[model samples]
Target: MKLSQLKILDAIVSSQSLKQAAEKCHKTQPALTMAMQKLEQDIGFTLIDRSGYRLKLTPAGERFYKQAKRVLSGCDELDKISSTLALGYEPSICIAYEQLAGDQRISQLFGNVIQQFPRTQFKIVGGSRFQAVEKLAKGEVDIGIGPWFDIFHASGDFQSVLLKPIDVILVASPKILANGRTTLTSDELDDIPCLTLKPTELPFDDEKLSFAKGSQVVMVEELATLRSLLLQGVGWGLAAKHVCKTELENGDLVQIRLSDDEDQFQSELRAFRSNRNFYGPVASAIWQGLQELY
Candidate 1:
């Protein structure tokens, strides 16, 4: 029933003699004979029959020999796989982050880690800050990337590492602008409503050049809906510059600065997960990579 017995059976079958099989297996003939007998008893079958000086395989014995060969071959394959893992330099790591940071920040971090560990694998996920952070908390994601103003204020619930500075841009359509992509004072934005995907309120320093309360801010949390509203030229919004790179490059959208804005950069990229088992190979690999990006 054991793999050892199966291998002996296979060797005996190929050698066609107990003496040769015993020598091939580095065991005495009597040991090989008893092993075969125990194997047949365990399987409830007759595996071999003695004939004068040679051996003949019974129906069950022939079947067992065929299976034994396969089993031995499989064992050999498993050993090879284990040995390769131990010897190879490559390792795999998984990560989750915003789509905006996937090709940019995430890759930048990966580049730093890969220089030291060239044969490492990283599984990347692209999602919003909310979705990515939730995954990290649930142990579904190794790292979360997003603006974590809420998480930072939550305090002591998790750990975070901050990267480069970030500032949400004021994106507007050409139709809404007379000067078109130039800077504007806050008074100019007072009459203009902003498009958003969700109902949320966050503060920004607008006293430098403009001051206003309650612009027609449209709520849109979904990317598709947000993009659609953005294309409509209905209002202006505070968004990550990287998120609209394609639109900006294609002349579909332009950034209008609030005049004399001193608090231009108010955000930073952060990576985090809930406190748990964080020292696994995956974590070590990604943290090493993401730190460079930061």
Candidate 2:
């Protein structure tokens, strides 16, 4: 019933010898045995089979040991969280991001931040476009990284800092660009389907989005899915330079340069945080890390 008794029980089960369990628990063999006896009496069941040379658990004893182990694990986690809280650290920091954010850079930034705050829990959530911003505003995430233009104008509840420009070039599978043409005109794009990401919080269509004027369009929520569809020659749409770098180099896909300078594709990515004056220690560290990363 007591935590100490559970520890003794677990030690006995693991060591398979009462003598070894007592040494491991830093208690005398008699004290450990008496504790086990009291526990069995309290539970109204025998926990161990002493007839064997090596300590063995009864069928019921195995079940109780398993549950006790889980309880001990929970206690350990509770202690860790409590210790982190006492040190003025947030228990967790969640970040939600759009696919256009550079994965390699994000990985590096996160790794550095984690090393600095070893006790802080981290969660990364991915969605298309403004979804990350919505999560930040709703307090579902501590930080949001994605396109900023629309998001900046859409919400006053959050503050944002420009991180970097995401270079999105129109691209399609080689088969879709079978004509071997480097340039695509607006008229040509009308006949070809355009794969695009669907914003989780806003309308499907954004007039300001690059190539939004394409007549044939397919909307999806994840960039990975759109990439897969593009590789299948389903359509053509603007893709992050880093995301399609391998494909572009391998000739599996090729960029479609816009014929008009007026239609050049590019978007700015920014890190957004809630406007609240206080960000928990972990979240504040993450925000500063992101600022330095860009």
- Enumerate clash totals for all models, in the order shown: 11, 0
Model 1 CA deviation exceeding 4 Å by range: 1-94, 104-125, 137-140, 150-156, 179-187, 199-212, 259-263
**Predictions: Cα RMSD each:** 19.3, 13.8
Model 2, range 139-173, lDDT digits (tens) per residue? 56768888777536555467888887877677888
lDDT of 1 by residue, 1-294 (tens): 788888888777777899899899999999998998898888898888886477778887887777776567557545644644685533555566765444565666566666766566667776652555656654455567766664443432577777655666778777788757457767677678877544222222122212225576566556666777877887776667877888888878887777655324566767776553334444566765666654
Model 1 C-alpha lDDT versus the unseen true structure: 0.66
Query: Per-model C-alpha lDDT, please?
Result: 0.66, 0.78
Give candidate 2's error at residue 26 in angstroms. 45
lDDT of 2: 0.78
Error of 2 at 171 (Å): 1.0
